[model samples]
Target: MAIKKKRQPKTLAAGRPPVFHPRPKSISRKSTKSLINQHHLLEKRKRQAIAKGDKAAETAIEAEIEELGGIERYQQASLQGQRHDRGGDSSKTLMEWFKPCFAEGQAAPDRPLRMLEVGALSTQNVCSKSGHFEIERIDLNSQEEGILQQDFMARPLPRDDTERFDVISLSLVLNFVPDPRERGNMLLRTTQFLCGPERHSSTWSLRDFFPSLFLVLPAPCVANSRYMDEDRLIAIMESLGYAKAASKTTHRLVYYLWRRESKCLGPESPFPKKEIRSGSSRNNFAVVLG
Candidate 1:
């Protein structure tokens, strides 16, 4: 009889799991108690590592915590808690607040008022159906037809001052700028696109109110929202020669319509003679969008 073939055992390497794999859905569905305990344990270990001056251990622990989905889960829970804490309908749209401003300008429709919507690529139809205003849409990162792919912060104003719009909409744009100073720059740049401060000789009429800014921003205290508060925002606008025409709030956003003051009464007014500078280095109060 032939000798039996030698039997071989499977090697561990042959049975090894895949090196790269997607995280399991079970991790996301983990029980609240389990998630909390895991977070606490990681925090305790991190603290211990810090106390022992083990930088490598601390970094590794941090990475482990992140990989375990601890941080993301906590952030989601915190946001939910915040929403429940602030009891108001969070589903309201920016257009609702903008409608009143639009309605006010309807009385003088002899000329089609110009309106510029910055960051309009995402929300294309905001003014598409409106007969009261002609809209010019501009955006920084969209390839869709009709969207002007220009960065609002870097581009120069039109050669003809008349090309400036009567109203400009900044729906859900300001919060992107993490710096307060840069946010101010975004507002100042908007003024260049809007009708400038009324000359001393112009008579008061509905047209005086034609050019206003419809702005929407996240609530200052909202979870994971921008750091700037509504009070500070209004203050910044006022300092930049805008007076708040109207304001409203949903659960998470604060919307305001700011009109250019007939005259900037503040000592720091940029409209009197100073050019609104986009470079932060050139001017201390500069608001650069880039």
Candidate 2:
């Protein structure tokens, strides 16, 4: 529950995003946490079973997950927890970070910034407010109206300028992926949907704010994982041509704004699984490329 906030300056230094995670005083929080953990554990096991070519094990795991009320139940619980978290929505943090950089309508006089929200829990978050962004929300399972029920990976690749977005949010998403390599692939895939470097708002007040990624993850994924830390995560992002625009760390979450500075070197066979830290209780969270 003690986190050394590495960088809370620039885009996101002052605000505290829901510290509801890791605190066990309330029954609701404990049950939600346990449910999420169970889902994650089962998902990991299913991945492992598939890797070993054990169809029987995979089938059994799927049945177990179904008995636990399936993926829909897990997603609903997550969405509910986000709504109930004491520290408001994650979009609030994303909006705060951009506010300091872009002067709203001034930056884009003709139109609003385009944003793609992956694993979107709701269509009613603060980000959906008019005049700032033309937002598109996508989740694998839709809990409500307006949010597209689709898998981000399977979503059609943009064929023209109209489909690409200025900003893409992977909020509390990448960590949900069971495979580290798949996580890396997912990160790479986002770049393709983002408007190219030419579309970056250079003349705007906060140059290069567009064509950026707003990423949020549970603190443990980076802070306490055996294979990942802030440094490692930054290195991976840098290799993908994203420079750290701003960062903030809370008791339960860490937030980042990765400005897509240079053109990404897409999909190189690099960033293999390497243990950067070792401990008894560290989680096996990693993002391996290729």
> Best candidate per lDDT, number?
2
lDDT of 2 at 17: 67
Error of 2 at 93 (Å): 0.3
Question: Global lDDT for candidate 2?
Answer: 0.82
Over the stretch 10-95, how does candidate 2's per-residue lDDT look in tens digits? 55533656556563233366777788889989999999999999999999999999987798778766866676454567888888
Candidate 1 runs further than 4 Å off: 1-107, 122-124, 197-209, 221-227, 263-290
Error of 2 at 7 (Å): 71
| Candidate 1 TM-score over all chains jointly | 0.53
Model 1 vs truth, CA RMSD: 14.7
Measured over all alpha carbons after superposition, the RMSD of each candidate to the real structure, in angstroms, is: 14.7, 15.0
**TM-scores for candidates 1 onward, in order:** 0.53, 0.85
lDDT of candidate 1 over 1-290, digit per residue (tens): 89999989989997998788765333222354356457656876887799799999999999988876765564343233223334322213434544554565344444567778776643335366556567777876544577687778987886765688877877656654434455656776777776666521143444435467888655542222233344545666777678887777665567677888744433263322123333333322223221
